[model samples]
Target: MTEAAAPRTPGSPCWVSLLVHGMGTTQDFYADLFGWEFVPGPDQLGPYVRALIGGKEVAGIGQLPPDRHLQVAWTTYLASDDVDLTAEAVRSCGGTVAVGPLDAGESGEAGRMAIAADPGGAVFGIWEAAAHLGTALAGAPGTPVWNELVTRETSTVCKFYQTVFGYEAEAEVSADFDYQTLRLDGRPVASLHGVGHALPRDRGPHWMTYFEVADTDEAARRVVELGGQVLHPPRDGASGRVATVADPEGAAFAIVRSTTAG
Candidate 1:
């Protein structure tokens, strides 16, 4: 995996959602680990879950319907002004348009979004924000604030993202980290880096979600207490203590608590 970068910018990285894993999990798994209150409601599609971070609606956790064979993992979303345009861009760039441009008005957010898996195989979200500016509790304990992608070919992922997202892809490799940050109008948007060999098919190329916590050790303990497994345990990542974990239902995700995150 590529080493992570210091924030290097004035604000926390702009991330929208961490959509990971598939049929093997229930929203309840994340609800307990991170101490969230779930609000499930029926949509035209069926029942969906929403939650509050800082008392403002920010993120969601949902299950694939019985017929959809989605893998268990999480992805981070970036806000877009127009998701339909983004979906069209994905098709033109050789990536698969996996989900919407479908309305998520039920998720306490207005507008449309579509999840796409890039040609390099990494999945990232493109969102059109409406009533929701994105996440409520950003860069804080128990919420997702920032993210990056680890791909086998940085150049391929970079090209695909730029072509699809209208980004100004950068070649400025970090001296401190083995990654490149995508920019839009000179603002950092997403990041890409080289990875080793192929990721397990079960663990496809996907964006990772970061949940802020006050204490990594405490969070790790809570994970086990709440019926989650520590896949990587607590280790020192560049920014802070990090761990790879799977909830009781088998959804894989990572956690970190950084003195520097917010």
Candidate 2:
């Protein structure tokens, strides 16, 4: 496993989180599926916990306010040096900032964060790390492996992210594929895909987080045993065998046995 001993590069995916209605069940489901242990976290937003693997933080899960109705999906957070400036860049680039460039946690130690949507309407988060440096461990089972934006087209949305985060976009050279990999400091950090009409009607455009697993097929099966649904069966992709699955509350994420996983 790779330990995140230093701060992640700006424009790189730093963390992922899920907010759900039932905290207990959500925690139990993930614990069983990924062998994650939970630790209490900032209560400023709500009852929240960070998921840990091998004693290092991997992700977070929080309980939403009872009266607030929000989509239950994993949010991918990109690292930033200044969240306020990034939020402004998002707005100036024709995107919308849905939540704060405000401090999280009572002492403002967790970090400053903002939730924003690109021009194509794919929602993602921006994080300026403070006491928390986002995901702390990777390249292991249960750790996040990739973050992808599934949208209608990549051109406009890619430009928005590039402007906001100073990301360099590299388009895939294929007649039938509309994919662009966003890079930071000469390394790929995230990706955007143009799915056209293949985008899910209910999900629309959104960011998808993929977690590494030892076996994609077994992980998909375990998801079913844990009361979740397999949205896509295990299949071979350029990266490796991968599958999409949703939690009991319908938060979708992918599991993959990456070709290059250590």
Best by lDDT: 2
Residue 42 of model 2, lDDT score: 80
Q: Which residue pairs collide, candidate 1?
A: 17-77, 19-75, 20-73, 20-74, 21-72, 21-73, 22-71, 22-72
Candidate 2, residues 1-262, lDDT tens digits: the string is 7799688888999999999999999999999999999999887688999999989999999999999998999999999999999999999999999999889986678889999988887889999999899999989999998999999999988888898898999999998899999998889889999999999999899999999999999999999999999999999999999999999999999999999986
lDDT of 1 at 175: 53
**lDDT values for all models:** 0.64, 0.93
TM-score versus the correct structure, for each prediction: 0.80, 0.98
Candidate 1: where is the Cα deviation over 4 Å?
Answer: 1-28, 41-44, 106-109, 168-178
Q: Write the per-residue lDDT of candidate 1 for residues 1-262, one digit (tens) a residue.
A: 1122222221123334433344224555666666667665324345556666545554666655667566656657666667787778788888887777787676535556677878877776766766545565556566775577766667777777766666676665555445777776697656676655655566756676767777788778888887788887888876688887777766666788775864
lDDT of 2: 0.93
TM-score of 2: 0.98
- Count of clashing residue pairs in every prediction: 8, 0
User: Candidate 2, which segments miss by more than 4 Å at Cα?
Assistant: none
